[model samples]
Target chain A: MLDNMSLSRHISGQFNAELESIRTHVLAMGGLVEQQLTDALKAMHKQDVDLARRVIKDDHKVNAMEVAIDEACTRIIAKRQPTASDLRLVIAIIKTITDLERIGDVAESIAKVALENFTNKQYNLLVSLEALGQHAARMLHEVLDAFARMDVKAAIRVYQEDDRIDREYEAIIRQLMTYMMEDPRSIPNVLQVMWSARSIERVGDRCQNICEYIIYFVKGKDIRHTSPQEMEIFMDNNR
Target chain B: MLDNMSLSRHISGQFNAELESIRTHVLAMGGLVEQQLTDALKAMHKQDVDLARRVIKDDHKVNAMEVAIDEACTRIIAKRQPTASDLRLVIAIIKTITDLERIGDVAESIAKVALENFTNKQYNLLVSLEALGQHAARMLHEVLDAFARMDVKAAIRVYQEDDRIDREYEAIIRQLMTYMMEDPRSIPNVLQVMWSARSIERVGDRCQNICEYIIYFVKGKDIRHTSPQEMEIFMDNNR
Candidate 1:
């Protein structure tokens, strides 16, 4: 018969494997979402309706991945009954996938803007939007990297990056407003661009949310709704 | 010593009490969020800056409640190690609080719109927005009622209500676009109104999400991302 120690070790090993599998799956989902965002941005820049439509079609894949990962996490919780850091990791994964799924939705929405007709001047307005989308995509990429490493420092850096994304979004909004005022006839098209910009801006916020989940998983602190100064002080004091 | 049956019953009783407490707290949080949405709508219609400011300030209370309830749920999961339906309930509460917190944020943002100076014409535009906000608030109220009852049929009904909310939102958008095209100088103010309308529309989506959570808790099905027809058929077949 197996000894108690051996049996416990075997169970622990199996639990760790389960956790590792979900982690890998989450990173894979993140990569797919990032690809969606990047492809959607390309579709907008190139006016590739086919690519945009593909992005929309692929969103179901992202949603499927979320549901799958969520089930795995739930199973782990029910079977392993993880406590302390282990439990926090499962909870964070659950929340993080929700945010990733939302980013995919945002990407799909941005791609829809590509299907709308735009004059050349209006297409010019998309240049700023492309810049903003690129910024958000980079944030998503770096945040996923931070997530993979579970690096609190890297998460904080990505969290701070949202401010730059916000500034870029504000600049685009101002430009769109000016464009609308200059040629009132372009209001409809410009409004579409504005909505796309708004959607991209939300991606930054969603990425920041994922970063908070990373920190929460690592530090076991719920750092959401905290001001930047407060977060910094908490990190400094804890470190 | 107590028998195994009595000891198990004792533990189950305590677990039930813990679950019940969190459920009560969630309903309380839902009530606060509903109040915030209603007051924000009132603030917009009446141009009441003080009420808007109060809504913004009171948002932190909503955030604090979410954190507290989340901590409690995490503790229950760690201690009780709830299985099956119990596990789903805890998980649903975790996701539900996140959605409720977001609705609070939407309320806060809409209230900020009241702080902006609006011309009489812009104020007239807010009448349609008021109608939309009221519709969203009702959905929220009914969804919370569904959540409290754990009624899948009620949840499905509330989920269906979101389509009407979407239609109302689209109509408001069309009105705003026409108004903006007529008076280009009103672009900035109209954009703010448009954003407020968008935020209120999101509350409908968030409520629908809560309804999904309620159904998931009761039926153990993940109904997210499903079309209305698919959802209806699933409900009918399950019934």
Candidate 2:
């Protein structure tokens, strides 16, 4: 017969494996979302209807992954009744996937904008949007990396990066407004471009949210809505 | 000395009380969010800067409630180890509060728009926006009521209501674009109005998300991303 300690260890080992599996699934989902955002941005820049349609179609895959991962997390909670850090990990995963799924929605919307016709003059706005999209995509990638490592410091860094994305978004909006004024005929198309830019900027905010989840998981403290200085102070004191 | 049955009953009763308390708290948070949206709309329509500021300031209360409710849910999971339907209730509450918190953010952003200077011509757009805002607010209030009752049918009705909000949003966007084209000088103010309308419309989507959570809790099925026809069939067959 197994000794009491060995049996307990075996159960814990199994639980650890389960947790690791879910974490792996989350990363896989994140990778797919990142790929979607990248391709959506590319499709917009290149005006590739085929690529845009593919992004829109593949959104269902992202949704399925979210539902699957969410179910897995719920099952783990019911079965393992994880406490403390383990429980936080599960909760964080649940919230992270919700954000990731929404990011996938944003990608699909951006792709839809790509299918709309843009005049030659409106092309400049797309270039600015491409820059903002790339930045948001990079933030997403880094935030996911932080999530993978459960790195609070890295999460904080990603959270700070969102400000630059916001600035870029504002600049693009100003440019779009100017374009609309110069050529009122371009208003409809510029408006579409504006909406696309807004969606891409929201991706940055979503990444910041993921960063907050990472910090909550690691630090066991909710830092949401806290100012940057406060977050830094909390980190320093906790360290 | 208590019998086994009595002891189990006592423990279950206490667990039920705890769940009830958290559910009440969720409703309270929902009420606050609804109030915030209503006040934000009123402020925008009446151009009440003081009221708008109040809404912005009161947002922290919503954030605090979310953090507190989230912590309580986590604590219950650790302490009670609730299973089956009890577990689903807790998970649903967790997800619902997240959506509620986001709706609260939407309210704050809308209030901020109220503080912006709008030309006389832009006032008409605000009237259209007020109609959309009222529709979204009603949807939020009704969804919260359905949540309180755990009424799947009511939830589904609110889910259907979101289509109307989307159409209203599209209509407002078209109007705003025309205004921008006609009076390029009004572009800046019109754009602000456009953003506010978009945010208010998102409140409807958030309510729809809450409706999905209610169904998930009641029916124990994940129906996200499913077509309305599929949802109806699932509800019908399950009934």
Candidate 3:
């Protein structure tokens, strides 16, 4: 009789507890993604094929985290029939998980590229790629922090970081193109590096996506397609 | 008073009609996505830069549709507090629209590649690319069809088509690599084509995502991470 009573009380508390629990999962997953990117970048820098393989294998954990979070969000919505901010939070978590999952995918792709760079000597663009990875990982970390705090201004700052990553991505692409043009022998390896660079660029996009959700969660607005200037203004006003 | 009365009535009827209305929006958005991919593919074939540019610009319409549908879903959930299948349907629609928006992004990316190809002559892989796009677009069309009817069998068949698209994508990538090796001068153009091919391959992924949602809606289960063999068995038994 006591166990049944406690179980029912636990279910009752779930309405308030679920959001905080989901946020915990999101942060845990964010930490894993950030670590995955860091490890992948290190693997690429050192050409450690073993570390690269581990990153690839560890992606399953990230996938599992997403499912756990999604199921949590779904369960909360079903039982609570949550409205207003609770509803928005559940919806935003769903969106945030998708972005987080995509970041894991990108990290996995980068790890594969890291594996490829082991086979042959490639250009010395690892420095640039490492810089790009750091920028993206920091952006992701900052965005997740902003999300936790529901800080619109902090999320807006993360959005601007995408531009820096984009510029770096373009520069790396140009360098890859030049290298490919000059050395036909390096085409395959260069192609792999191009893909890795592209994946890093996509990480920037995932960061932007997370920041957008943070804005949505706080402001009750979808600013994904908004102009940059407008987004900035809205963020400032909300802050 | 009449307007207010009718609006309240509409909100009250939203429990059943909301799902149907969201379905209409989804199909409308799917139709536009299908059209965008078709036009983007067509632009690649004709090398019609003008048509490609138009496709790029037209992507905003798809984005707008996403926001509109999203708002509708949010409004329904908040006002109706729908339970059971109605809640699941609303949540699934939210997921589906994300995939649809991604399709729009991919289509826009393809259009940009189509624009790039016109800068200088490149390898002639458009025929294969067009075939891949058609397969993806068809898969998308069929999945949306299955979704509308809640036909698990049809959705399974659409899921299987992803294997065909992946194979075609690999074959095209090989062809592009061969072309790149033979002619270093074509590096830039070939890279753009490669990006476009990669985007098409991702479309196949988005199709599978939609099919997963269909199964979720029908079976009240999330099979997104399920192994194909298990998914098949579950679907067969469920059927």
Best by lDDT: 1
Candidate 2 lDDT over residue span B120-185, tens digit each: 767877877988999999999999998888887888889889999999999999988887888888
Q: How well is candidate 1 docked (DockQ)?
A: 0.73
**Model 2 C-alpha lDDT per residue in residues A1-239, reported as the tens digit of each score:** 11122223424587988988898999999999999999999999999999999999999999999999999999999999999878988999999999999999999998898888877767767877878999999999999998877777788788889899999999988888887888898888888888898999999989999988887877778998877798779767644
Model 3: DockQ vs. true structure: 0.53
For residues B10-113, write the lDDT of model 1, one tens digit per residue.
34577888988898999999999999999999998999999999999999999999999999999999999988878988999999999999999999998999
The C-alpha stretches of model 2 lying farther than 4 A from their native spots are A1-12, A235-239, B1-12, B235-239
Model 3 agreement with the true structure over A49-91: per-residue lDDT tens digits: 9999999999989999998898888788777877766788789
Give me the displacement of residue B92 in model 3, in angstroms. 1.1
By summed lDDT, the worst window of 10 consecutive residues in model 3 chain B runs over: B1-10
Which stretch of 10 consecutive residues in model 3 chain A shows the poorest summed lDDT? A1-10
Candidate 1 ranges beyond 4 A from true positions = A1-12, A237-239, B1-12, B227-229
RMSD of each: 5.2, 5.0, 6.6
List of clashing residue pairs for candidate 2: none
Question: Chain A TM-score per candidate?
Answer: 0.93, 0.92, 0.90
Please tell me how candidate 1 rates in CAPRI terms: medium
Q: Cα deviation of B34 in candidate 1 (Å)?
A: 0.5
lDDT of each: 0.89, 0.88, 0.81
- Interface RMSD for each candidate model? 0.6, 0.7, 1.2
Task: State each model's TM-score restricted to chain B.
Answer: 0.93, 0.93, 0.90
Grade the docking of candidate 2: medium
